[model samples]
Target: MKAVVIEQFVSNFEDLKPRDAPLPSSKKSSDIQIKVTHASLTHVDMLYAQGLHQNNKRHVKPPFVLGTEFAGIVISSPSNKFAPGDRVFGGGLGSYAESICVDEGIVRRVPGLWSNAEACAVGVSGAVSYGSLISVARLKRGETVLVLGASGGLGVMAIQIAKAVGAKVIALVGDKEKSRIMKELGADEAVSYRQRNWEEEVRALTDDGEGVHVVYDAIGAIESALKCLRYRGRIVIVGFAARGGKMEEVRANRILLKSAMVHGYRYGEDGRRDPRRTEEVWSGFLNLVEAGGIRPIIFQGNYMGLESIPRAFGDLKMHKVWGRAVLRINEDVEATKEAARL
Candidate 1:
């Protein structure tokens, strides 16, 4: 099997190299074996390659697989929940190869409505968006919700999910183009934070300038997201997409004045600490997809073979790609269907 292996942390994507390795063996009873069809690159993957994420760098060592989300078909599994040739998608390790092994507990069946690429795109961003809105944020019907970084993968999903839950969504992006995309994804209003007066614009957009009921801050810049929140508003920090600087100063008096809540979420931590609850959330995400409440925005890129993993990581680092970047790993049944249609 061909895999992309990172021997050491390097700033350039060229540091990652493609190497041939033996195919992964399947577990006979306890684990499920998937013939990987597509694996999507994420911002966190770039950070992991750059040795930025503290947890990813600590747990994942060199000569390890890079991809975190994938969609494929079951080749073999002892669990009755899946069987030979069952289509499924979820998050796991070593997904940049032709096959991957995952525990039966974390994987879920992909909805028939989605393509292989769409399925591959859903697990990480979709789960985070839905979990943050429905689980962590506890968004209420008719409440106003703000989605920072609303054009990225998680942001796009958050826009749709917030609307699905009956919240009026105000999307914030870096540019007008992304703002347009956010509106297309179901945001009631899209604001670009690039403008100097954008925060004031956000204040004016909501009713009585009361601030939004919930702000999903995917961009980790603390001050921008915080400043936009209204009194009693809650901000859920999911990722730091922009301004990877040290945490800036936030006035405690502001928190006291608004009586707002600041919360941070790590999807992997939440999944590990409460596997059953995580599984439930994952199921809800799939249900949303099935019901057409959410859809994956796939930005098509070069369909490189296994050898191009390093360059793919490089593109990710340079922010050259948008939405989900999927690499096809194998000619599984679903992939075959997609290819035939194409």
Candidate 2:
């Protein structure tokens, strides 16, 4: 198998190179062997490579495979839930390879209308959006929701998912171009955080000049978003994309003034702690995708083959990625007719 192996954490993504590696076999009865066709690139993978991700620092060691989310065809499954040639998409460690073995409990069938690249693109981000908006914030129809970092993968999915539930979405991005893109993606209004009074502008865009009912803050802008929250509103912290990935501080007074509820959402850790509930949420999200309520947005860049991984990582770090960056893994891994129909 050809795999991108991280022998040691490095400051540069260029140090990550492909090597011939041993084929991975299923270690658990519930595991399924898959031939990966495409994989998603993310900041988490960069953090892992730099030895900066909190979870990686605590649990992972050197000499491990480098990626997470993947879409592929199943080669074998012990649980009988999936058969050979079935298309599936899921997230697990060691996905930057030609093949991988993952637990069936974590995998889901790719929707009939989706391509493997699309499946790989949304595998993790879509779940994060669902968990943050639907599970944590309990976003309701007709309520106003504000999304920070509205051009990134999580932000793109958040906008669509919020809109699908009938929420009026206000997307905050870095510039006018991204703002326009978010509006086209179903945001009711879009604002550039570059504007000095963007927070106030967000509040003014809400019904009756009141604040938003929920704030989906993906870039550690909780303090700024606090200025745009309605009374008894909810703020769900998804990530610290700004401040060089360091967390931002929010004043206690602002939260108190709005009578707001603030939550730090980490989908991976939460799912590990409560698998059953995570499974239910994931199942529901898949249902939403199957019904055409949501779709993955691939960044408008050409990323193909294992060698493109470094380029994709560079784009992600530089904030050039508008949506998910997907790397084509095995060109020959085609979808079966039966799997494509379902």
Candidate 3:
């Protein structure tokens, strides 16, 4: 099998590449064996490669496969809920490979309308966006939301999810093109942080010209995020992708003035701690998918095979990718072709 193994933490994305590796061995009876057809490359993957992710620093070590979200066909299943040849999409580590073994609890059948690539595109980021807005922030219908990093994978999903719940969405992006793209994707309005007075522009889009009801800050713009919040508004800190991989200091005085609530969003860790809550959040997200309120916004790139991982990471870092960048692996393979490759 081919996998992107992080032999040791490197400072550059180019230093990460794929290598021929042994097939994964199942660790438990509940683990489902999947032949990965498509996988989502995320910012966290790059962070892991650079030893900057909290998970990497705390637990995960070198010589590990790097990816978390995937869509594939089941090679075998230990339970009746899934069977051999069933099309499924789910999330776990070691997805940047030809196959992965994940517990049945984390696996889900791919939604009817989505392709393998599409399911791969939304698997984890969708969960994060849905969890942050609907579960953590308690976003309500008729409320207003400002989604930072609106052109990125999570932000794109956040915009659509907020809209599906009847909330007005204001996307805060990096440029004019991203602003246009966000509006086309269901954001009620779009503001570019590149512009001077961008925070004021965001505030002016709100119902009362005070501020938005909720701010989904994925890009470490907490200071500006606070400025764009309404009284008693909710702010969900999803990530610090913009802060050069360092933590940001939030002013307590800002939180005090508005009587605001701030939540540090960590979907994966929260899911591990409370299984029931995970189920509820995932169910709500899938329901929205089934209702056609959400769709995968895949980057326009032919990222095929394991070899493309490095280039994908580079593009993601350069902001060349608009939405989730998917790598197609074994998607169109025949049994003979698979055998021939081996």
Q: 191-218, model 2: which lDDT tens digit per residue?
A: 8887798889999999878899999988
Off by over 4 Å in 1: 26-29, 243-253, 310-320, 331-333, 337-342
The C-alpha local distance difference test score for the whole of candidate 1 amounts to 0.77
Best candidate, TM-score:
3
Ranking by TM-score: 3, 2, 1
Q: For each candidate, what is the lDDT? A: 0.77, 0.86, 0.87
Question: RMSD, each candidate, Å?
Answer: 2.8, 2.1, 3.1
lDDT of 3 by residue, 38-150 (tens): 99888877787888877877777887898888999889898798877777888888999999999989988888678788888888778889999998899999999999998
TM-score of each: 0.90, 0.94, 0.95
- Candidate 1 C-alpha lDDT tens digits along 236-327: 98988654423457777777777888888888888889887787788887778778898888767776667676767666556555567777
* Total residue pair clashes for candidate 1: 2
Runs of candidate 2 with Cα error greater than 4 angstroms are 335-342
The lowest-lDDT stretch of 10 consecutive residues in candidate 2 is: 331-340
